[model samples]
Target: MTPGLLVQSQGRVLPVGLSVLSTRGKRELELPDRGLVVGAVRPGSPAARAALRPGTREEAFRGGVIVLGGDVITAADRQLVDAFEDLQSVLIDRKEGDPVTLTVVRGGQTRTVQLTLDASAFRVQGR
Candidate 1:
């Protein structure tokens, strides 16, 4: 069946329902129902050196600890990131080498992080 048709029939025809598959036959899905997207890390960049990459989920903690899910971005200036593309747009407005304070929400908690942009880094791919 077509993916669109399958999606429409999902949960209706079966208990688990049908799921759309990607070109490789893997099920495609979105990261956050609403949150940020982290694109890439620049070589020799502070973020990279700090072990921050893409697909990192940012969440706040009771102790104010910021956790980086490699590169999954979740929020900016307290603004909820619904998609990665949208978050990228906002990041683009700033310089690559600039350091910005990011508020991350993860695991039902919130934490702030100091993210330093790597001016030399560009997005190779995103989740």
Candidate 2:
């Protein structure tokens, strides 16, 4: 059966509306070695507006099914991003409406996607 949910619903309120897996998370599962993996993209959000997609592949991790094979975010604004925290760290300092550059690997080919931060994006301090 295809898995579905409300939130990782853990982290959000940032600029983008998508769930991602850190490279280390995949490493634990012995999956592909790379940057943060795109897990899910919220509809109508900036991520969706930018055409970010989730993968068709699925794997069991920590008693839950994790979607894989979408896009791997290798960098952001020329800065290395190997984990969720890395991406978060980059965006947290930027204001909404600012343009951010993301480097993503889709289907073994790398590309850059640029999108302006949405007003709905915010951060929970002390997280």
Candidate 3:
């Protein structure tokens, strides 16, 4: 079994990269962008300590009616970013402290600018 492709327990082959996760008993707080929206920046953290917030959303209600509330991310270095995964994919290839320009839409206005990357909230852990 040294070169075995799997280890079976109770007749079930254990999958690679398998780990137990608790979706139960977890308080799921819904944020604007599938909980990926940056609501509040921690003081003295890489973001707040630096200066970044959830980019504002552009594209007005087109009337009194409205739709999604999350900030609309327009672009990353001239590349269009239309979804949350797009932003995540870009960040994955980057490292902390890397400088980047993000085009954000807020209140129907679009602005392009740069920001330094920081460790995501998920990566930072309490001692």
Candidate 4:
């Protein structure tokens, strides 16, 4: 799929379904770490379908708390993800049903997992 698909569908949207944070910025905002952290995984989304895990611990951030220590996304499709935008840029041109390989670190163990983007995972608000 492409952005044209989004234009054609109007309210349909494709999403990874994971609340991801750039640990490089998170060091000052949340963790004293640097990497991409999975804060939460949306149920039934691609991330969830891939069995992705979220952080283990919870801490206050911006007056709200979210999971920490779950999984660190080091890369996607063999491309380095040093920031949230890095991942965004890599996936911007991708569409639903596109296959992706993710490098995830959990409990200090690194592993790769397969994922496929899904447009049905979400919709435009108020649609």
- Per residue, candidate 1 scores C-alpha lDDT tens digits across 27-120 of 1222233344343455666556545445344333222222234333456556555444444556677776776655544343556677666644
TM-score top scorer: 2
Give the 10-residue window scoring lowest on summed lDDT in candidate 3.
Answer: 17-26
Please say which candidate is ahead in TM-score: 3 or 4: 4
Whole-model Cα lDDT of every candidate shown, in order: 0.41, 0.60, 0.40, 0.59
Candidate 1 lowest-lDDT run of ten: 1-10
Candidate 4 residue pairs in clash (backbone atoms < 3 Å): 55-70
Query: lDDT tens digits, residues 9-99, model 4?
Result: 3445332222333455465443434346676677877888888887656554432344566776778899876465556767788888898
| Candidate 1 local distance difference test against the native | 0.41
**Cα TM-score per model:** 0.44, 0.66, 0.45, 0.63
lDDT per residue for candidate 2 within 23-52, as digits (tens), equals 677556444454666776667656677777
Off by over 4 Å in 3: 1-70, 121-127
Model 3 TM-score, 2 decimals: 0.45
Candidate 4: misplaced stretches above 4 Å? 1-33, 60-66, 120-127
lDDT of 3 by residue, 17-125 (tens): 1012123311121121212233334565544543545423322221211122333345666665544445556667788778767665544456665767666622633
TM-score order, best first, reads 2, 4, 3, 1
